[model samples]
Target: MKKTFKIPMSILMVFAIVFSALNLSVFAEEKESNDEYNFELVQKDDNIVIAKATHENGDELYATLDKATSEITLEAVEKPKGLLKFGDDKTTKYIVKAETIDPALDVVDVTIIDETTKSELRISPEYVQAQLPVLVPVVTWGGRALLLWLMEHALAMTIAGITAYVATDLISDIRKSNKNYWPAWIRNNNVYIGGDAFDTDYQAVGWVKTANSGEYNLWARTEAKAKEAANKAAGTNVWHQGKPTDGHYDHYHPAKPLVTDPWVVKLDNHLWY
Candidate 1:
């Protein structure tokens, strides 16, 4: 008879406690879209995007995206750009089947607007948290960091780049309210700009997915590792890295311009002291 190795529950509990102290979150490039921030997107063109939603007041919100380029800067450093308005509301943006982003939307530029101020409402973060909690948020690596980055740089092109770079199926699944997700193995390398599959050249958005798992990677962890974690938690051998026959794991980065924003600069600090 074959014997199975077993550890006492008490020891496992200790490991869990130690792991909690680590708070070792894995930073990833793409995040899973969920019901929390649902938004609808239509590719008007290869680059143009149109977002539409019925407001809480049953009015309407029609936002046209010029593009999300890394070059987006304040129109003028001396003055502030005007904000597109939203009233008092909280709901996820509908999403699936994303359109590619053009590398040129300005933070100060106006594309979406309401004829009246009563349509889409922006509520307090606290209120939104209280009202609409993410029962099961499908966050990416460094999930909290991604949220913080978005809150701090909502108008930055990095947001668009991430939207573009994230796994397409994760984006598509949110609309279907699906839990199972998949990604194309070949197409997801680095941003393919002006050429075929070259390991250089960046996309216009400039932000690539970097990790922060406290392993000194200066980048995000891999989906393979994520699955490995799940396997450990489940006490199963579900995580597979390439195959036993193959030596290398399957993974790659994606297209984008290089962004050196504050968060990115901080990420680079890993390379320094």
Candidate 2:
């Protein structure tokens, strides 16, 4: 006789309440983008470098730099809600003028004073152009929290277990029809030499393959040497016999080949015949 275990409904209710409370604590609050600025170089129009930043309300903040004078100015169709400053101290301000142009990697680097920290932070051109456009929708986070909460309930857990069991059996059925074999290129191009086989330097040789077939008769020392001698005569690199990994077989095929085919031991010393 087999025994089965069941979970009490009271414990499941406790789990649901705890999971919901944790989700609400983490994701209940709404988030907003700060007026804190960053910049990216969009394009260059003659001597002027055109750049763009993102506004908190999802609008473009444009800043232009003059190549000749090294003067940069920020211009937007609508004025920003929070005033943009350029330094750590609250007094160091950037209204319409900047001191100099420091360019790197085709992007101009600029410093901005964080409104909350009252500290200087540099925003690179790449960050402004490449990264700033990605916005996380608040609704997606709320939906994710709701999905997690539902997953903790008893009914949903039962459904998940059943689905997982069905998926495993389906995968096993799919794999039954498939067979594992070596790649065609390896079997077609390479030759196998093994059974205490040693090269000119007495180095243990493993598998040997001809670069060009029908040029030379490749040799395997023993009949047990993966593949029959008759298979070698057929002008194919592979054989019906399996590969051998006995003795100090060559791990790295660094030997100079006598033939054009670089027949030698290779990495993962196993040979496919």
Candidate 3:
């Protein structure tokens, strides 16, 4: 009985050793596979960030970065084209362009250029935060004051003033009034285009006055009749009130001709205004 137990114990030990050896072999293979390729940033030129990777076969792969989407692409050797391929080594190059980059955010694009077939493998940016709703705060204090002053009797005027004050406060609270005079989205992105991008149905009159001339720059209203009037007067793409610069409002119309002044509008709000 003792001999039988010893024989089984020895067999168990041998099995354990064999399993450990197999695991070590697997780990070594994994390490060797990972060591087959290495990456390095090679150059940054204007809107392009160039990177190079060396494969085990001594073949070099090139990549370009698209800063906007944080995507990398394999660059063609000669032309500014992409999708470059070499031999069967299957090395990939990643390219990142500077234009697509947001420095405030650590956005990066990585691309794998297949050396054998000249194909690309792209990795997109992972958005960490969800987009927040944009709200434009319009203060109606002046209008309320005017309404209060228009009351004839002193008592009546006082009552109206109180009502106005309460109403204004309620409206302001609902609007989540911004003291800085800009929408939260614009503030977050530090964008100041002097334009209106808000849902007009909530307010009768919304305008941003220029500091210099004290004239309305952009205006929108909830009243369908008012919007229709403004749209008609300004054409379908009407400037209810002109921007300080002619092109300031140009970006508001995407379909407008390229020659249109201020041809582009920065889109701070994810929603189309």
Candidate 4:
């Protein structure tokens, strides 16, 4: 018969405890999250959008909604410390005066710059796709928000044909409501909804054909007016009603002309009249 040596139960118990401790350490290592992003962009309300960058983790950033370009701008702000709860600071708010949102592009058209060198900020494509859609709706307008949202959905629903007809009647009732009046040049018609050309409010309208950007119509019969209106309506950028001699940047000032009129001939390197 072969003699067999018995293993100690105490040693076996010690080995078992060691194995369990090793497994727990491995589990913790797997559970730790990779939070490398610098800011968390969140929409607090319909008119409240902000980026949180406190303590560890995000790039120091602030957001701007430019009224002139109808787009959002992201700038590098001094990284703030401690807790930044919503509505605590005015600097975090996104709206500039008379801001307009471009509905055709993704949720918001974000532009960033290298203020250090005045160049475009280098960012990955992954960031654009991940963040822009859920950002910057923190604008306050009662019906205009609804109108813009409807327009965005309408644009998304059809790209080529459906929108051409659907857009015209989208906001008919809302147009008559006095509070939400930002004059848009009425598409395919010669009339305006909220007011007239002589009203002289700061109009910030975008060029859109396939969706809801149509507003007030034209009453003037002059060829210059017609051409200006056409260029404004037909999606050509850099065309708007000009400021008058009085230096007021008002719309369609009668007997006054554009900063650079499409009709006027310049005296540079050409035949002078």
Candidate 5:
């Protein structure tokens, strides 16, 4: 009896050790998958260029520009709230700005004003599976055991469980993808110039489209002329007209030209053309 028990016990111990080793291997693989993404701020004349590259372990790398001079300073800034997602991939963001040096020369002062924020997401699925050899075998054995216990009902129960697990995992992945994607919200508004400094006022009208949200938030400037233009463009009869008060312009309307598709309007007295 002692010899018979010893054989089974030894086999079980070996299996347990194998499973634990497999789990540890999977964990190590996950750690080794740290790829560093690269981001850079390039200053060219008056323009600052922002560039990014995908890598495995971006968080461990220092975020700094190679071209750090008195005339130009590159700084990386923390990724903005709502701009970053958790556990997708490593990412770094930098803010590059150019300032005027003097009215004398064409040379402008360029600087990176903030430290880049670095973040790392979850390990890749390939690594997770590659490291865990025992997981699949264990799950398979469990399924087999469950089927054996169920006897006549085994097939149906096993299939249902697998289907449910797969469906749940699919949904979770979809949600995770959605969370990681970021959509840009572009806004353009007409800057109302009052007759004088006291009359100076500003109005903005545009649409906001978020990544997750399907609907757009259409809004027009509240100033009198802006409001009228927006309403006229929208072909809507509803008008909110008010006079200039507290050193601002009167009622405004949204312009139809601005609301049209592929909307292009003058910004800061400068046209794209």
Candidate 6:
């Protein structure tokens, strides 16, 4: 009999905690790396605190603190060019204000607007804690190991999945190109553009079926010519909107233009829109 390894609950808990911390650390690092604030506490004394602030993208914001009264004031020297998301959901836009003042010690006051509803929200460090998800360890069997493995190789898995999808799409395209083979008649029949000569109000109408189960793109010089061409091509004198009576040629159909020296279809053997 083969013995299966079952991870201990304590060890599983430890593994979960470690993985959670690593995941959180990575997310935090990414968020911090995207920090737009270049602001830092420069000087603090009994009377005042001064901080120089700049945006990562060159927009400037400055802050100052009054130590005696424990008041901090922040202001934007120049408005940030686009919208800025400060919270975790990243659905909020940081509103550019001329001034911001801290009401008490260890606290900074700021105004941010929700991007969707355009509602104003006042947020501080304390209220922002709820934005982070609480990491809880779930008990599992051998699957816990698989979870750890997947977490370790997430990037590789993602790349493999994308490559597979792209290869599938490429294969489909190749098969379609192979199936779009043109018949001998389509290859032989040359497009004739005669509408411009016969009448000023003439145009090319819909395609008519040919003798070889193929199709020929035809342009009519006038309404009478259009009716005549339809009758000759399909042995039917009826058109979609009946026979056009007015001299104005309203029944225009899409046609592919000739590409080669003999005005033939393109190499792909498909009609150009």
Q: Mark the 10 consecutive residues where model 1 has the least summed lDDT.
A: 72-81
- When 3 and 4 are scored with lDDT, the better candidate is 4
Candidate 5: RMSD over Cα atoms? Answer: 23.4
Highest-scoring model, TM-score: 4
- TM-score of every candidate: 0.23, 0.19, 0.22, 0.24, 0.19, 0.21
Candidate 5 wrong stretches, greater than 4 Å: 1-11, 20-117, 121-273
Candidate achieving higher lDDT, 1 or 4: 4
Candidate 1: tens digits of C-alpha lDDT, residues 1-273: 999999998888777666554413234223323322333433344344454332222323334434333121111001111131224433223121112222222121111112233222212222232232232122111122222223122222222123322222123333343222221111222221111111221221122222322111111133543333232222222222243123223322221223453311122111100
**Pairing residues by index, what is the TM-score of model 2?**
0.19
Comparing 1 with 2 on TM-score, the higher-scoring candidate is 1
lDDT (tens digit, per residue) of candidate 4 on 1-273 = 999999898887767666644423224221111242233444322332343332132224444322223233343333322333223332322222212233443222222343344443222223332232212212111112222343333221112111121223323444344332223332222122222222321132222222332222232223344334434444232224433233222233112223575733211110000
Note the Cα lDDT for every prediction shown: 0.26, 0.30, 0.28, 0.29, 0.24, 0.30
List the pairs of residues colliding in candidate 2: 191-208, 191-209, 211-261, 239-273
Displacement of residue 204 (Cα, Å) in model 1 is 16
Residue runs of model 1 more than 4 Å from their true location after superposition: 1-43, 56-58, 68-164, 167-249, 252-273
lDDT of 5 by residue, 111-162 (tens): 3223343221111222233433342222211211121222111111111011
Each candidate's clash count: 31, 4, 20, 15, 36, 0
Task: Give the winner by TM-score: 2 or 6.
Answer: 6
Error in Å for residue 12 of model 6: 60
Among all windows of ten consecutive residues in candidate 5, which has the lowest summed lDDT?
A: 154-163
